[model samples]
Target: MSSSNEKRALSPDPAVAAPVGEVAVSVVEAPVAKKAKIEDDGKTGEEVQTETQEVKIDARDARDHGIARVKAEFRVPKSDYTVTDTVPSRDNDDESELNGREDTSRRQKRERGQNKNRKFGKAHDVIRLCEAIKDGGVCSHGDQCKYEHDLSKYIASKPEDLSGTCPVYEAIGYCPAGVKCRWMYSHWSKESNKSLVDEAKKAAAGREMNRIDRSEQLLLQRKKFPTPKSDLILPYLESVKEDNIARNGGNGGVPMTNEERADNAATYIEAPIKPGEKKRLNYSHAKILSPLTTVGNLPFRRLCREFGANVTYSEMALALPLLQGTKPEWALPRTHTDEIGGFGVQIAAPKPWQAIKATEALVEYCEVSAGGLSEINLNCGCPIDLVYRSGAGSALLDAQTKMLRMLKGMNAVSGEVPITVKLRMGTRDKTPIAKKLVQRLVREGDVAAITLHGRSRQQRYTRLADWQYISETAQIARDTFHEVEDKNKDGPERAPVWFIGNGDCYSWKDWWDAVDNYNVDSVMIARGALIKPWIFEEIDAKQYLDKTATERLEMIKRFAHLGLEHWGSDEYGINNCRRFLCEFLSFSCRYVPVGILETLPPRLQDRPEKWKGRNELETLLGSGDYRDWIKISEMVLGPCHENFEFQPKHKSNAYEQG
Candidate 1:
């Protein structure tokens, strides 16, 4: 078994024994509970025993109490359940339903982890309004349209308006959902049967960029979208591959002579574009939010931006889906107005052709004139099993020659949009290959930047990021750059490739340490940003801010409001917002309040034991239970639908009952 799995298999301390099959072993030693002492009553002269209540201790306090390790817990028990009752029993109906397993027997036998087949059903209105009626535009179908034409009937049948004003209308001066909006009463007139619009606000509202036009999408779907640049670059890449094969004795198993090799080199075609010609990128000391999958949606990016994230990347979109003109894939590149100057579109491809074409499409559609794309990032570090098995993501690390070709082709057709690559240490744990890759990246690949996530594909988040290895690699990249520059003194001036280190950077100290000590240009934050959206602010202040529970809730409210504006103010939108909110909370709840922390900088892996917050609201915000996350969502997005369900992507998020 792998070290990570072995770590999980180890049992907790027997002395502090929890219920069978419920205890999760912590790497950190458990803090010994203080013993209660007997006290004498002054008036009665009778001895009285003092009751022992739960005591809260911070990192410092835990250490002061002779504890050698931080008392951390990945899975937390609900408020009603004692620490011993952390994980719920299979017999619990509520737990089973929330876990998406209705049968108790199935729940008992099944191992806890990702809910791969979880279903999300959209909420639909009983009487759907016609697009013509909603937008005041003519419908081509006219009377043939199945949608309701009578605004009165549609409004009457619509569910009662949600409380409070419409966030979308409040922000942009008009609700796109119109009368069908959940909060329509805030912007609708009963007598006039018309939706109100703030003409001035609507006109002044900043439009989101990179929305794929219907015509462009249609062209892509028909495989007619012009990829003139890719057409040229792909043939050149293939010719180079053929030449390499010939030189390596592929010509009837006979190796080419020196004369033949020279001839082959002379016949090699020059690339359409050079590294120096690409747009310059300066990410020095920048705080970047990593391209998270489902949790890193636009609303969350917007929140991080408000909190001072220097750069944000879109979720990794698959090249196949993007080329096929799938709406979901197309949506990955969509950026909010605030993200225009700092946004990057990350794509994953298994082949050179796919990478080249995908880059061309992104550059063509998401042009600078249309919002803009800072860079095209090739994702080579995703550790998901499905992506890895498909010969993409981290699998690229194993296929370096193919990977280098993909990068080269991407650079050729990317125009001014610089192509960057995100990578891992290697495919397997303890086998670091990035140091060697860095030399090749500088000498051959014309990438704008290189981001090395300090973990191997096999390590995942099971171990701490290897910043020492990342530092060594960064140094190698610098030395390689100098060597290459000296070798090509007469060549065009190229920008120095920025090196970014990612993984386990949870605090300002972590960020600064990577920059100051590790020789990295920047640190890409993933889980850290999810847990504390205001982490950038902390970096700026160079100190931890003890955010009140109210302040945190307000942030949650802002995210929900932004989600509504981006997704829509309709039932489906609300459901999406609620579900994503829960997803965010799943990570956010892992944050141990700085105010309660006895230590200055908290490590990402140091999971705190069950501890109360300064207040009830703070405790709720720090809850590990998915149900509490829903309660927090209800406070903002309103109650979820009866069929609404959420299962955390990590198995450790749920606990078993005692």
Candidate 2:
């Protein structure tokens, strides 16, 4: 090699450094050939060349750079094409232009001529009538000379007036005498003849016959009880799952343990109270709560479901939480397959967009695989100061039109889910308008079911639930819908929606009493389940078992296990579980009484005398201290001892709302 050529080969190489999390760069090269001693292009298509191309570096810092796409030509065989797609033609101008023009023309014509057709037609009809009166004034109003000669001016003045005017007499063309003349033209207005006859003929048409459209109308409105529809998910007694349970992870919707299915004869469900007997009113769905984010308290929710409590609602999830992808809050409506038998997720939003977004979020997450959400409940029941002031929750009753809009928004995105609603009676005047509010929801909102708490915002939970008024309201609701079917017979379709009663319900007797005496469809159980997780079992058992202290301890243990398995043993979750478990104990402890109240005041939740003493509560917990409640909570919830401590949820009202 020449000295000058050798000098060029010894220069240092320049290569970019590797990225933080990237593949190493490769120094690939082509074979080097001896120098070509030749012309630039006699043989253009074929050339012997060895080119040194720079490597394609994958430097992570390039992420901050802007991209500019440059076109490059390529000619490859058809087989080399990875994908082939047919392209649509871009030359359909006339079709698109004609469509746009037609739309614009239609709109302009509607604005300029369509709405004015009535006025224009009326003018033309009068002109024709005037001509008729001029040639032959057939008058039924041959009058007593005041404006006796002129009925035409009166007819023109009152367009729909049919009885007293001549169509031709502009002011009065004489003939002042009183008589029925063919020329005075008076008995009826000409415009009525022009349109009324046509309208009258249309009304004369009718259905060949009318029969009681049972499918079209629910019998509860005005007839007898409705026969149940087939194919509905059967409500099995809350059977135990000991045999079906696996030591393996994931429930897989298989909760029936082998022992449970086999022991079906072993009193799996307590017997139900017969209708018409004296019963507790505290077993109905009441104390409507917001489906607050993060699921309020899972340990409490599980306890309610495990005992076969009637109604369970999820925390009220915000519309924005789902739409904007906020963490955790977006997952508030999450539920399980076993829960769908009696589950409702109440969603809240101040706008139509939120309702749409929230309903979509529910559909995506609340599937059978994730959590089978049974009902999509709109949260129009919250009475909190902040929520009420925001024009959501109970405040929605004031704007029926807006309420309809939100319901429609939810329905649009709900897919196959039934849209249920939870609402307060009203902001005020609970009784009189109860019927009206229900009618509006039924007619305009198209709700599957409605759960009305018996108090208004003014009353809060301070006053007693006016049961008779709620009963009357529900009766009125039934009657009003009965009249609607009779009116809009051929307009559309309808469905039989269940009217669930809600309020202070805490015992088995309250449920049976509400159903038989007052005639309600179903009852919701809330604080009743909270105070006594096993209240459902006791209800099913016919007579109160008073649950031996040992049984109570067993439940506390199971609840703790479910809580830990769900919340995990992380620091945050352990503390959260502890706080909620304590809150639950504060409630459950209220159920274990030293003696039975031959006549307990309706709901046990209403009166905690059942388990009220510091010592009595301890005895109930199988111990004489509150700390035992935490220890029981811990045993089931896994080792949450060193990591977290339990906290109380209710105010120090001492004996107030548990």
Candidate 3:
């Protein structure tokens, strides 16, 4: 919104707020919400009808107040009641039976119209609350909302819903739909026109809401998971012309040139893992949710070796494929001896049987010290609708019954590997029942830990994460678990399990801030590392260090070789390997150029393209042979290929629709 517009809205009497700027007219009608939002295919959001609303403002009042207040409004046209769909409309001159009923219907329709208009005009409070709830929708980062307006659709769909209360209000202390709340449109709108000006008395203060930290003696009889968190080298040689201009002043005294502007716009990402920590994780009551998505197919065991990541999880593996034992994709990648020795394999199961049967064979593969893994991670966090509708991923959040069934079955066989579930905020907006669900999972389901993804399934990855709510949930976890501990003092220290945070981790600074700011155990990464592989190394080094073109090429070469070694040497396999390796290179190679790059230890971002390959990439880039990448994947995953064909299992963005 424009500053002037905001100023007008703050007018003492919003009705008098001013309208500014040229108004935009839309011909497309508002969409109506389909009752059945999801079907066999997938979830297609609601559809609403739209009718034009011509709002007229009093020029004098608006100019004084400085903002515009909605005057008149339009509604998306309602479906016509006709003879074919329902009964014949009174428009038909059918005499006898229909005559009297037509008049009655007319009266009812008039009354409904009056109620709707009155409701829309007064729709503010509940609508604001609904707005808050929608605003609270998860962003890639946490839930400290800085936005003023989010989730406009829910509000825009309903013309009169803005005035009243709804279920969302009761659950979240506010509504998100604004004036469009269901209650607002329902015929129960209320408005208070007069107040006694505080009875001529002064206003008084009130107590603030208190947030108590309650992590004492908790035992929610649940399982837990381990959570964990780097940079870039440039490929080009220094750009001397740009460098000189940046150092001196620019032409016409512009702060930056077009070239500089282009460079500034390029996207960058940080590493996923925080390295150089003081100790290894205590996995006694912890499960590792891995192989993390930092560096593609980068093994958990290797991460443990490099950064003391005591526990590691396999990337989410499909239960059906893994159970079939023919899974070659990384989404359902297998765990090696080293990783299994440290942590239990995480399984993404849509049904209870998948969780049930997989646990049986999975346990045999794990060889932990006698008792085995600390916990088995149930992948309830996947947002992919493919898994959700079947009671897997975040979809599990909506189906409490199915979730309980899956957890119960998994718990039955969890001799050494306790069953734990990871869930997002809920299936959609206003579903704060995650706390309630967590309670159920602990009490009836008997799971171990509840790692809450601070987003709702509705969010996918669009909005900011709600950290405040995560902390609130954490406090709830502590309170619930602690009470259980007090009741059952003999049960091991009533450990409150652990609360893990995810999303928007771009740098060590972000990781430290989250830990210090939110008291989370660990965080998971996916896209952040896709653009920067050296983040872990940077964390361990403790200081910012830029890598030169030559240094980065070496890392690239090493990664290529690792890929080749892991996949093997066949032409087709190696080419596929090279393409994937190049994709990684394309992103990771983008470091800050010149002046910015020079801020660190080495100077490389400014370097020219000729400086790209350490030895020379002219041969490698055009050759299309990735003997180098396979070698790198091999070093990371270990040897493979009898027919000289490279095969890698770990993968993401798997739809590959084309």
Q: Write candidate 1's Cα lDDT for 1-658 as tens digits.
A: 1111111112222243323433333222223534324335322222223223233443234444322232233223443333222234323647645554333222233246766665565687788888777744456898789988888788789777888899999999989887778999898877666778899999988767898999999998999998888887787678667777866768654555678667665654555557787668889988899999999999999999999998999999999889999999999898988887789999998888998999999988985655469999999999999999999999999999999999988888887788899999998986889999989998884798999999999998876889999999999999999888898899888789999999999888788878999989999999999999898976775545556678889899999999999999888889889989999998888877654554445777775656666667877998876667888999998877655766656544643321
The C-alpha lDDT values of all candidates are 0.78, 0.47, 0.43
What's the TM-score of each model vs. the native?
A: 0.84, 0.51, 0.46
lDDT of 2 by residue, 1-658 (tens): 1111111111011243333332222222222323333445532232343334432322321211321111112112333322101111114434533543233323221111121121100111222222223323454545432232344553454323213332212112222211222222342235433211123433442111112233322432333322221101011211222222333334655555567556663542322211112111222333223243332455556566667655566778666655555555544655543354456678777765566556755665455233366567887777777778887787777766567666755554555566777777778864435568788777653577777777787676655576786787777666766777678788655555567777776666666567666646776655566666665654554334344455566777666545544553323344555656665676665563322222222344243221222233334363222345566665554443342433233212234211
Error of model 2, residue 68, in angstroms: 80
Candidate 2: misplaced stretches above 4 Å?
1-299, 368-371, 429-432, 488-493, 570-572, 592-598, 601-645, 654-658
Which stretches of model 3 miss by more than 4 angstroms? 1-310, 329-333, 337-341, 368-374, 490-496, 539-542, 570-573, 586-658
Ranking by TM-score: 1, 2, 3
Q: Name the TM-score of candidate 2.
A: 0.51
Q: Give the per-residue lDDT of model 3 (tens digit) for 1-658.
A: 1111111111112133234522222122112223435444564443434343422222232222322112122111223221111222223425513542233334221101111121101112222322233323334433554433444554454333223223333323332332333343332222421111222222231111111112210110111111110002111112323444555766534355678656753432222211111112343322233344324453323333343344555566676664554335323333433343455457778776666656654554444344235467787778876777766777777677667766665555544456667878887867667778776665552565667777888888665677777767766776776666677776434234656666655444444555667756665433444444444443443323334444445565555544433343223334444545644643343333111211112211122221122223321331211233344434432342222332222221111100
